[model samples]
Target: MSRGFVKESDQEELPIIPPRAPLPAGVINYVTPTGLAALTAELNALEAEKADFPTDHEGEHRRAVAVIDGKLALLRPRISSARVVDPAAQPQEEVRFGARVTLRFGSSGREQTFQIVGVDEANVKEKKIAFTAPIAKAISGLWAGETADFRMGGKAEKLEVVKIRY
Candidate 1:
């Protein structure tokens, strides 16, 4: 309890926990059946990781646990608030949440396909986009062969719904 008694080396830096995807305020947290499973799996993995942490290195172990706990704190709310929607139950005629849609862009006339998924489940590599995304929103109520104007990079591009599948 004396001045300059504490050493700088004794201080530990707090781990920086990354935030999950942005779910806008007032928007419901919707997830596909598979998406909920994925979240559950993630929670299990984190729990396992925490339980298996080596104890010999006390400081490192503590930090790791803190990081895991921080991550869990962020994840639990998402899991609890999740409203699972069955893709198979959605209407096959129009684009909606959990629907795999194929779109044909104007001018280039090129085709691309993506699934409208939950915010937490959105992965570009998997061709999954969030329901709140602009393109997804634009095509939400559209049926096959219907066109919608989407603003991409401040320019409007026409998107035609070529196909929709749950």
Candidate 2:
């Protein structure tokens, strides 16, 4: 029972499972129809990967399976909780979920376009932002030519809605 009696082989490194995109508590898991389809495709791909896991190298296969399992565990709940919202169903004149918005910064007079999407669907590189994002929240429900203030890193930035599209 002494610590000195324990064997080094008994100790093993634990697997690290990466966290998924944040979805704050009490917030609905809203997804665009395209977003839902993407998630479903990812799940299917993961399943196929797991099924084809190589068994020749026991340790490699085990580690691979563990990683796949971790991803599936996180993804399953999000998929189940998803509420699909069609972009075409949203108002074409006002910014809302699944709306592609064009904004102009008041200070710099620079224009940028971004689409408001679900958490899992958000990718800055793709010009898609989550509905929960500060910029998205500030402009949501706003119409063209409307302005809203957003605070970023202790500075307030004014954003003007230049255009909205489904």
Candidate 3:
């Protein structure tokens, strides 16, 4: 059968799938207990949605299934490689993964709080930052009332750890 003989309507365009969140190479995929639970819930929801997809329109159904499968493919590895870290189990005296830290800036007398979490669970709106973030890395292992020099934009600013809680 020649391509010129085929109907144009028979050709199906592949669905575009979005990429997952970036995780740097060589870094372990660590997830808090809550983060792992959320991922599991998301996977289950996608599975249910795929299972309930309507089959009345064959092309639409196939495209929908393909998109869901793509998402599942990206998600499965994250879930499988996840190393769950319990926030409560961490040391309470110092900054570490899952620590909610309060920091004061030098000269400004201003304070801010952030929770150091896994890459999949980092949400700026919620004041949660990934453990790999520059600020998080700078402040890691510091005890309450300790200070660290944070460099940004070629300028160094002091960050004082006011409090640490798991």
Candidate 4:
């Protein structure tokens, strides 16, 4: 005797909802609004263009679309990403996630500053670097005044952690 329903013999169907998978540990996940828009655009583009490519010759296109999807799938995580690290933290001499590092470019006569961020907030032009980046990996857990070397344009460059801010 279902309330306000049909006969008792009529079976009611329950709503179907899929369970989501848990995020992996230590994998930081965060994305700025800009990043979210960019990923959404990529998704739209992929969906729109995927049908245009011939099924027999869409290997490269398919892979590219898959990559975009993979990136979008990281909007959440089990372990918070370094990009979302607390910005209000006090400045420290040690290099770590969310630290803004100033490095002296070896090849060029200039100094470059980068905010060590998670992959979601990484915008090289904006001087935001992902913690998982080569330079970040090399500098992470190192104290200020420590120098790390990396190759750029096939030439070696030395970078010094001059300053860090929350």
Candidate 5:
């Protein structure tokens, strides 16, 4: 059992598993129905990949399976904790989770539209923002024609709600 008797080739390197998007402590894992479905799909894909690992090279196969397992380890809890919220069931009169809101910047008079979604589903390229984001927090529960002051980095900007849709 001495280190002098151990071989370097016998040691297995742990695969680096990337962390999922951050959800602040004690914050409920709220997810849209679509977001939940996407998480489930990702879990299924990882399971399939783990099962289909090639066995031609034993070490390679083991490393590949370990990586997939690590990913699944992180993903499973996220799926399990998901609380799906249906966009259609949300109140349409005010901005809430899953609401597609259009806002006009008071200073520039430029309009931008984005949907408030869960942390896991937030994608700026798709015009979706996390509910915990500063702008989303500032505008939540506001109705069309209402204004909210969004402050970031010690600077504040006025945002006017131009439209709200579920």
Candidate 6:
């Protein structure tokens, strides 16, 4: 009953798992239902096939598990907090995460709309662009009606920001 003593059965130390690093801030993470489903399916397939890995392939199997664990870890976290650059909680200024920016080309006069999202949610074909990409970099902090130049395929291409939305 003394505070400094414990029964031998209760003296075992509990495992202390190290915490993962905090996720990046100020980035929009938009996950499509299809993408999440695919990720889940892939993990499932890995689980189902994991039993077949031979003892000789233990290294490869562990590597595979690590990869799957990393993917699942990222996927498991719900995008509950969208830390945009909006101190007012109503962003109406420079490009920030979760912003739908409209770009207008100064040279060709072409315009396009893109939603800036995190790396996991970026699909150029779907127009959900990654904030760290080259094209995204060109327009990340630009304001509406502003033009920015990009070099692609050895040619200088022009882009302009026409609009943005949350």
Clashing pairs in 4: 28-81, 29-81, 83-118
Model 4: weakest 10-residue lDDT segment is 75-84
Q: lDDT (CA) for every model shown?
A: 0.94, 0.93, 0.93, 0.61, 0.92, 0.62
Candidate 1 regions with alpha-carbon error over 4 angstroms: 1-4, 7-10
Per-residue lDDT, model 6, residue 148, is 79
Off by over 4 Å in 6: 1-90
Q: How do the residues 1-166 of candidate 6 rate in per-residue lDDT, one tens digit apiece?
A: 8956876536644433334323356544444444345445755765666556555765556666566555555545633432323322435777766677887766677778887665655777978876667787787677777777898778898887778776
Per-candidate TM-scores read 0.95, 0.93, 0.90, 0.51, 0.92, 0.51
Write the number of the candidate with greater lDDT, choosing between 1 and 2: 1
* Candidate of highest TM-score: 1
lDDT tens digits, residue span 39-137, model 3: 999899999999999999888898999999999999999999999999899989989999999999896879999999988889999999999899999
- Over 1-166, each residue of candidate 1 has an lDDT whose tens digit, in order, gives 8648987547788899999999999999999999999999999999999999999987889889999999999999999999999999998898999999999999689999999999999999999999999888999999999999988878889999999888
What TM-score would you give candidate 4 relative to the actual structure?
A: 0.51
lDDT of 1 at 120: 94
Candidate 5 regions exceeding 4 Å error are: 1-5, 10-12
What pairs collide in candidate 6? 102-162, 103-160, 104-160, 145-161
The residue-by-residue lDDT of candidate 5 on 27-135, one tens digit each, is 8999999999999999999999888878999889888888898899989999999999998999899999999999998878999999999998999999999998989
Q: For model 6, what is the C-alpha lDDT against the true structure?
A: 0.62
Which 10-residue window in model 5 sums to the lowest lDDT? Answer: 149-158
Q: Model 4 scores what on Cα lDDT?
A: 0.61
Cα lDDT, model 1, residue 127: 100
Q: Once superposed on the true structure, which residue ranges of model 2 sit more than 4 Å away at CA?
A: 1-10
| Prediction 2 TM-score vs. true | 0.93
Clash count (model 6, backbone only): 4
